[model samples]
Target: MKPQERSELIDALLDGAISEADFLRLEAELHVDEKARRDYYERLELTTLLEIQAEAEAADLEERIVPMPATGRRTAWFATAGIAAVILGAIALLSVVWAPDPAGGPLAAKIDSRLEPSATGFAVLTNQADAVWDSGGALTEGDLMPQGDLHLTSGVIQVEFFSGVTVILEGEADFTIHSPMEMSVRRGKLRARVPAPAKGFRIRTAEGELVDLGTEFGLDVTEQHSEVHVLDGEVEWSPKSEAMRRLAKGKAIRSGNGGGTVELSAQPGAFIDATGLEEKRAAVRASRRSAWLTHSRELRRDSRLLAYYPFDQPAHWNRTLTDESGSRLDGAIVAAQRSTDRFGFPAGALDFSPTGSRVRVNVPGEHRSLTFLCWVRIDSLDRWYNSLFLTDGHELGEPHWQIMDDGRLFFSVKKRDATKKQKDKQVFYSPAFWTPALSGRWLQIATTLDLDARKVTHYLNGKILSEEAIEDEYLVEIVRIGPASIGNWSDPSRDDPHFAVRNFNGSMDEFAIFGTALSATEIAELYENGKP
Candidate 1:
């Protein structure tokens, strides 16, 4: 086909005006010709750019047409430019309004498939109050909910589905999320608010299914029976053995495992709503915050603390991170921005996303045993090694701590007399504990090096993750922390200008170093007091 003819065919395709035969021809051409694929993308880009330019022009009408003195050549140029702009504007308008039906033809289907967004999750756990899971796993606010079962043994949680359905679940409850608009209650109580967009949201029980019709409703499920209460709209209840029945506002029904249904009165007050849940969460957070502050004050007075950065300095002290342990080991903040901490305190954390972002400190002593703990929110593990802390350079007794690309916690101290043959000379690693699902969630990570016991222990959220024996060859009697950096590695010993890119892509709210190795109970207390 000629260039003009092919362009016309693409235009027709984009406008949804291509006939079946023409679409087939275009599909074959796109499959065989690389130029055709490039042309398609180029056209799409051009249309998008034109649309953006049009919107910009509309926003500033005075700047849309600029006056210029006209020469004969300028006049001709302006005429050509005006014609081109008009054509581009028409194309943009057509592209915006005339989308092809995805089911119309093979080409349309292929294009639509490419344009679809990738599905990450069915819903999000938007809010929670004093939640305690049956599995003893931590589920925080703003966690993405995948298609799986949730067993909440205590407290309340609010989940907002992608399809605009909100559900407040009260424990002890067993719930399963099948999709954005579908869920199941094995045994529990829940209140749901379905917007117009999620009108067909359905909840299944052993006895029946309750489908929402743009309404607020509550449900209770047990071993013997299931109850549905329509609070403000309508629902279609389908019993396993009976025909479907529509229930209006202020109506309720009960379906039993024995195959019978009974009418009941809707009690809106029996289930907690979103507003009530939020109020409860606020009270809980305030109480937790107060308890944490009191514990923090006690921690600062502890003699074992070598250095502690609460990251709660006022705006005027942005450049210097205060050392609460009173060791005078202040840190110099370099190129890091302040951010909100996990507990919702403003400027209570330091974000280290930019290159060369770090907190430089000088501890000025060697230790026989050490404990390091911090609260961090990792955004990504993009680098081969995401630095947590590292001494100036790799010398004997110098410690290096970091997260490996595969999500394992890594710590090592250089040994003075290590042979090349020893494979495990100085390195220790915890099991891989981080995944994409954990991105942006605050985590309490702690590592202790107990030289006397010859053991290295790693903890996550106060729970032991791994404990490895410090081999005889790998044991360093004294660990040095004269000059080091948090969230990045900096080597002042090197003459060369080039440096390794090991900066952490995350935020840190609290970091501390103890001269003595803390026991498991101490670590647990720290997590419990500071948890958000």
Candidate 2:
């Protein structure tokens, strides 16, 4: 790699990027290149200076007396590097999935350059609208991160924007991450979410910037005074008054007294994925456009578990679409879907059914984490576990996440070992779907998981629907998906997918997933996109 390339490579490495293999390759190259080594040492010195500046700044920031925003959800942090537990499912049945609309929403980007498979996150993104997503652990110059329900394990995160800027996240941090366009560190310690713009990209922060093209990642800053986090990407991180750290993911950098910086630890290099690079970039754009102070409200309608997709766009038309009618609310005051027959009311709900044969995301690939959000209206009761999604792992752990026969939402995450499967059930409310105008109206459902957090959360129309946890650790190979029809369960002569009718009465919309967990801010963002 040329000197310029070496510098770029160093920035990515500092941001927690570059696999062990790649790190070794770079290290060997440096041994023979004295100039490269010299240049690296010089940069390292500058970063050290920046860290010194940050400590002083943090002390000064203490005088401000800032009020922090509520994290909303509590994360059950888990940090054991046990078996990866990531099973690679062959792309056999899911190979030829229906084409997703080429015009899917603008994707959010993850500026964190270092997202490893085991580095748990519970958030994701899709275009301008989505449930939640992780940063995908990539810190591309223009990468985007998914918004909504975000939670991180005990680790640091450095996010950058398209215009050469960055923001760093500290441990156990949780917040609704919007793009670098407009951001606020409601919770956790963020270096900065603002960056200087380069080319066509424009960054928004305390005071947005227009940076130059030649920029590196990880210009992080977190305000303890207010528990706010900021990421300055691309542009050279020369703080105006010296404040917090502006280094990469693992290392620590500060902003103050000429902007000092330093390496906090020397953990082993973790592997990274370059495949989902595009999706990560899109997250940046989406986050850039998100509003900073949006509040999310739960949307719960009591009716039937009818399939509902938020938009009437083309891609959504690809998911399994099923419906029901003359249905009554199984639990709530009314029903999730009222009967008068409003076919296209929600515009793009899954009245038809996204699948017919097997269940699971029609897309190929064995993803480590996933988020499933749905809008449902139900009216009938049937035998067995009525499921929204199932995989080869059924009643067994990793096989099913469903509304059980007992009118409760249950998920069997890890069925292999009794210990793996939560000994206690995370029995949550199975509020029958809600309908329009009716007491039991239609509502939205959002669910997510973060491997590191060792926890899961369920939401109903912005509000947390399930107050409990699903004992099973949801470890599955195949992904099954469907709107429990009149009768269908894997168990023959016993449990079957049940409902009032095949075509659900209510509308479903804005159902998607992310690599990480969704946050309240993100949920509110989704509501805005899918709101009437």
Candidate 3:
């Protein structure tokens, strides 16, 4: 790329407007071109210096100069006596704020590392029964198990390592996943079933480590001691101060924190096995599915609903999504595929990962207030704007609802006689609530625009996330949603041939639009009844 173009791309990166494609291109350039890397560091340093200068001016301390050591290639330029003292002082201050490597490495390398995507995991959270994590958010069944500390305060969870080792952990425990074949227990009980392919699976504890020899075993670890029980096969035990010994099935050993080991008979019933956990999860799923079905039936009868899509088609190839609210405003699926819903029912949801994938619908007439709600499982936020419901063309009185790339919930409406300036537009944003850890987990997202009350509210899983007042100058008395789309955006008035790609990278099982703003009690009830 040209120097000007590279600078523009760098500016966009700083401004948070660089597209994924452009970002990848810029990253590749920085990796191969030494000059580009230097330019990037120079740009970053200049930006930081400007910010410091602005702050100093604001504090009326611009005259003060602090001499600090400078490193890197910029040191020679700073040593020149011709440079302004204030600029040199600012550069010195910037160097202190962003200390470079003592060996004189470019700062671009550090910044580039931050731009790289997060590491991928080899294990998956296969199942959980009433699992309550210490982090507050429960891990969903299909979530990828991150390699880190896992604190389970209550219930049981099953994890399947890539090496074919299945581990069922009981609650009130602290565990860490070092790799697919290795883990550590600080405090808790767990049962592991290792197949022949994963024979050498390892488990470390405070006392020592246990190496599985294609065996099924139960391990309990606490501050005072660690215990191991060979449930079905042989395992090699190595205590901190004792010689490694192999123990067969029906044998158990306990090692105290201070020293010595005690032998005892194996207690297979002490830990919940994978099979038992599966049975419990199945029962809970069945109960939740039944309750959701009854709740869905009642929701269809709500008189204030403008349109409701259960996304429950009779067949996978069905293109029409029936409106359960009797509005006859059925949606036509466009290039989206049928997928599993939050309830684990096959072909019960619509996946909108592909380009041009959306559910096209038309709801006639304007409304004084509006509410948009849905249950979505976001796979990733790959686009600048991941659409939930956006009106076509974005004309006056039309509303747009979507999720920002940073995971904030966004809702806005075009006002009557509004100019192109962004300040004239009223937009509501909720604090970012989604993260990489939340990928594939089902979430209830809702947004209400109460023009009469002059307020907008956003909800996540039944609780209010944010509330913003609708300024009188920016409020549209009648909100319109004439021709719109679910999971994507369509701009009819755009002169450019290439359309913006804003399709949601995930699945949605249910969506509803209410004619009036729903109360918090009603939204909470909806979440309670529909949650899986």
Task: State the C-alpha lDDT per candidate.
Answer: 0.86, 0.38, 0.87
Clashing residue pairs found in predicted model 3: none
Better of 2 and 3 by lDDT: 3
Clashes per candidate (backbone, < 3 Å): 0, 176, 0
Q: What is candidate 3's lDDT per residue for 366-390, written digit by digit as tens?
A: 8999999999999988676899999
Which wins on TM-score, candidate 1 or candidate 2? 1
Displacement of the residue 427 alpha carbon in candidate 3, Å = 2.4
Between the candidate structures 1 and 2, which one is better when assessed by lDDT? 1
Candidate 3 achieves a global lDDT of 0.87
Tens digits of per-residue lDDT for model 2, 131-162: 12244442211123545645654444455543
**Candidate 2, residue 67: CA error in Å?**
88
TM-score per prediction, in order, is 0.66, 0.29, 0.67
lDDT of 1 by residue, 1-532 (tens): 7767778898898878999998989877876577998898898788776664554345346745533334554545435556678888789878775676655876566446435653478899989999998888866776777567889999999999989999999999998999999999999999999999999999999999989999999999989999999998999999998999999999999999999999999999999999999888888877877788899999999999999999887594569999999998999999888987877666889999987899999997889999999999999887778999888866678888899866799998878643566542467899988776678899999999999999999999999999999988678779888899999988743532233657999999899999989999999989999997
Worst 10 residues of 1 by lDDT: 492-501
